[model samples]
Target chain A: MSAQPTVTHKKRVACVLAQFDTAADVIHAAEKVRDAGYQSWDTHTPFPIHGMDKAMGLSDSRVGWIVLGGALTGLSVAFVMMWWMNGVDYPTVVGGKPPFTTPSMVPVLFELTVLFSSFAAVFGMLGLNKLPRHHHPVFESERFRKASDDKFFISVEAEDPKFNADKVRALFEGVHATFVEVLEVLEEEVEA
Target chain B: MAYYAPLAALDEAHLVAPGSTLAEVTEDIASVTERTAPRGWWIVFLGALSLLGIFGGTVGYLFYRGIGVWGNASPTYWAWDITNFVWWVGIGHAGTLISAVLFLFRQKWRTAINRFAEAMTIFAVICALIFPGLHVGRPWVLHWMFPLPNQMAIWPNFKSPLLWDLFAVGTYFTVSTMFWFVGLIPDLATLRDRSTNKWRQRIYGFLALGWRGSNRHWQNYERAYMILAALSTPLVLSVHSVVSFDFATSVIPGWHTTIFPPYFVAGAVFSGFAMVMTLLLITRTVFKLHRVVLMRHLELMNKIMLLTGTLVGYAYAMEFFIAWYSGNEYERYVFVNRAFGPYAWAYWTMVSCNVLSPQVFWFKKLRRNIPLMFVVSILINIGMWFERFVIIVTSLHRDFLPSAWGMFSPTVMDVTTYLGTMGVFFTLFLLFIRWLPAVAISEVKGTMPQADPHFHGHSERSHSEHDAHESAVGGDLVPEGAE
Candidate 1:
């Protein structure tokens, strides 16, 4: 009768995530979680929740800086390549146009700039988000899979400095989460 | 209250269908790909495959012989090859227009058709690239188009519009495929989660790139999508303009016109829309996707056809007027000969089909008539091919020296090759429909009223208040039990 050893071994509670039906509820829960001084938390939804950045206290994304960097690199590369190739290397004047004609060079310059910037935008976004990750503690919850479908969820991780399991569970309850769960990171999954 | 009634009703009508849920949208669109191919699909697939076989045979034979097997000769060296090249490339433009330009403009209706159009853009560009590849005859040396250093120390003419074409089309294909794939990620996730089969799940799961639809990911995705769309807008416009430069940069009278860029762009959009309409009409019927591809969508496309068709007509008229007004004898001669020369039949056919045929769309009844729209779409496709034929063949046939003039007629190879490419286009298109989500599921889901968190009771409230109210009433807090 010693509480049946509630578990045979110690279990790691990764995060306490709650499901909310509407975008507003998740936004509200997010605001409450933010106000509660939780640093490691996130909301998952089927689409981009408008103004959720403000709710989560996030600053503007760093993706634009990356894209701009790429664009400038592309422009420079095009300029140097065209200058070196046509102007210096194999300077054959055709149609009476100058070998290093700026006008003729614009199309390639513009095209390469766009190509590089686009590559940067896509890969940069993926890198910033840390995507292609097959496993997350949040995914351990069967109910959490609905995040990509009709449900919205806010997950406050155990890694948060202020994370106290009981307090976080109560916090979700206070926000009237329809379903609340504490995700566990299994030993095997962690090892794998 | 009375004043708000109509606005509310309009908003209600904009919902995909009254009372359609997010789950229903996902199920309806995904189920088409999940299910077995229907009888019509097999029929069309076989027909397209047969045509693809013809294409393969024609290409093999052409390779065995040479460029001499076709109708290309001195002065008219650029015949059906260049014509089909321009035609296919032009058809690809409409896809970019619908996806990038309309997205920037915030036309939500584009969500319904953008996926289909973008796929068309990719496929059309593939068919287009083939012509330029084969036209070199010695396909092995086609790499010479690139500015790579060679043993001969010969570099491609950087100033040549043909070189510009290589870069334009190469960039267009890469950017378009990236745009289409990025847009497909979320929808692929939906399909992956919904699939019951293990292999299907694994494949889609891999393509989804472990997307969990986290708000963080959505934020980055939305920003990336916006950036790509902005990038693609200029790219699309530049692609056709560069294609026009292919001719305009040359000294050929009909080809060397300042108005070619805008005229070519408009004609590209016109023909692209016509091709989209034809495909969509057949698609909606075959797949029973009328609810998704609505009559409203069809009518809107028809109107675009009408608008762009008029722009093209005006360009044709201006070309003639400018030729006459400028008193450039060569330009005037080209224009007059185009209308009343050896190819007068082809030229007038272009006029009637492109300019006159679209006028019927001014009447809403005709625009909405599915059969009439289909026929008109086909007619426009034919007209556009003829338009390219008129531009390339007519202009090249009788150049500055009438002594070098010759009437160009296609050999069986030319006809089969063109037909073979059509076979190639349709074959790929059919396969695409069978395998992929024809309509973008996640995007179309966003168009529904239920997509908004604060949307309730046919009205919207401030976010904070709505959140407070939703949390207070916790019973409705979970959506229909997670699927």
Candidate 2:
């Protein structure tokens, strides 16, 4: 089982996706799987499960850093744009005030900072999550579709070092999953 | 454990109705969109569409003619146009307050209403945007508001508050739309999964961006939501403040006051809440969402209206007191003239509607009375509009040069145009409710007792034992039943 197979196949087992009727069941299974040292596994639910982050052992998201970076960039851009436009590029004195007053520039500067930070926060989240994905192997399992509605699910990927189909099936059964399914990667999906 | 019981008891009052399962919540909320539109919806939509038609015609005629089409004159350049702009923008603020501010404060009641409020904010801003664009007269050259390179090489006057309004309103619309969309993602995914029709599934699936609701995705999503909420809280405050600057930065006596920022913000909240109440009342009745919207929610909103209304009334009095105390003849004249001058009818109407009407909520009976609250909300809406009208028209109609002062009156065009925006607002809003989950199903589910991992009677261990077991496991994952 440890040896690499040479034969080319159109499909391969990606993971065993189990469906649970309750969050506690899924969380319990996730803890068991984590204890068993499955690295490339994930749980899914309709909403964020409280303390699932610890169960899954995911670190804090990096989207905030992206937002901060975008905000600083925005501030810099605003300063440069205001300085270059009003002060250097085409200078004009209005209301007997200097061309570039800090008080007046603050609103635009603040608006731009928020604008950029928001964009960064949203797009960075999507990018980090690798979303807009048209297909995934888990979608092959009809039972897994309930992940977005009422059911709770856990999918342990084939890529995990300790992945053994027989053992994974036993583990899911031991945890009393309502349903368990094996997802298969299609030939076209691999080509795409 | 003894101390924790009270808190747990407090949370048991269902945010969602008791006996609601996750599947039921999804079905209940999503079914509204999946089903046929109600008769009431069609009636409202048709009325709004006709009004939108009137708005289109009025604007078209204005563009063909000139700014002279409206009642705007030499002295009263800012009349109904600016008034409507300020009023609509102010109404948009409550949505952000509910979604971002209340979320940050952990006010769970907001979940039922925030989605609708956010939708209203987006729609209201669209209506508000129409005013500035058209008010510029040349509407075609509205791009001049932006700092773009032109053949003339002229940059917009960045020092001007009008320029600030551009940035403020622009950023506001963008961030509000983004915040609303991001919050919609998970809900949209739920809708997608529930959808049986292939086309419906495909469309909702595409909009859902293939969301799987994976734990990792939810972790990132919650973090991003928190950051957006934090960003939006200040953004909401600043947008209205910048709008206040549009008036305050002016040398006009009534306009140039430091109190305008907070005063305007309070007034915005007051008006926005009233509008939310007005819409939600109709919505709950039509959709039969009483269980979700709840009497508690409506009463809470009324209380907010009472508080903010009082603040607005106080501001009205403060403006007068300050005007009198400052000893500035121009300032004092503007205040007195607003109350007792040519537009005094409008001013008094504002005072009665905004200040006097909401005071009825001081009685608990009145607060819970839906019909009474509905009427008061409508009155407040009308009153807030008059508040803007009084501020803009009265001050501009009587400037320093009494010789140049003129009494401004609206044209047929102005009246229709204003009414038309209402048409536009409702048309968009009607569509929103018909297609989307007006109450957030997923969010409300999160507020349920079942959502908690250690929820009593569901978990095998006692709450304290569960906590101890979690801590004992620490960074390491414990096997099932390890404790």
Best by lDDT: 2
For candidate 2, write residues B1-483 as lDDT tens digits: 001111254644566776667777787788899999989989999999999999889888989998789998889899998899999999999999999999998888899999999999999999999998898888878888899999999898889888888988999999999999999998898888778899989988899998888888888898889999999999989988999999999999899999999999999989999999999999998988876888989999999999999999999999999999999999999998998898889999999999999999999999999999999999999999999998888888897988988989889989998999999999999999999889887788787655665443232332454455455554232333455
Kindly provide the TM-score of model 2 when superposed on the true structure, using C-alpha atoms. Answer: 0.94
Q: For residues B1-483, could you state the per-residue lDDT of candidate 1 as single tens digits?
A: 001122254554562665666666777788888999999999999999999999999999999998788889887899998889999999999999999998997777788799999999999999999999999889888878887889987677767888888989999999999999999888788777778899988998889888887777777788888899999999999999999999998889899999999999999999999999999988888988866777888888999999999999999999999999989899899999999999999999999999999999999999899999999999999999999999999999998988988889899999999999999999999998888899987787677665654455233332465446655654332432121
List iRMS for all predictions.
6.2, 4.5
Candidate 2, chain A: TM-score?
0.91
Supply the global lDDT for candidate 2.
0.87
lDDT of 2 by residue, A107-169 (tens): 999999999999999999999999988687778888776787778899999999899888998
Error of 2 at B114 (Å): 0.6
DockQ, all candidates in order: 0.37, 0.49
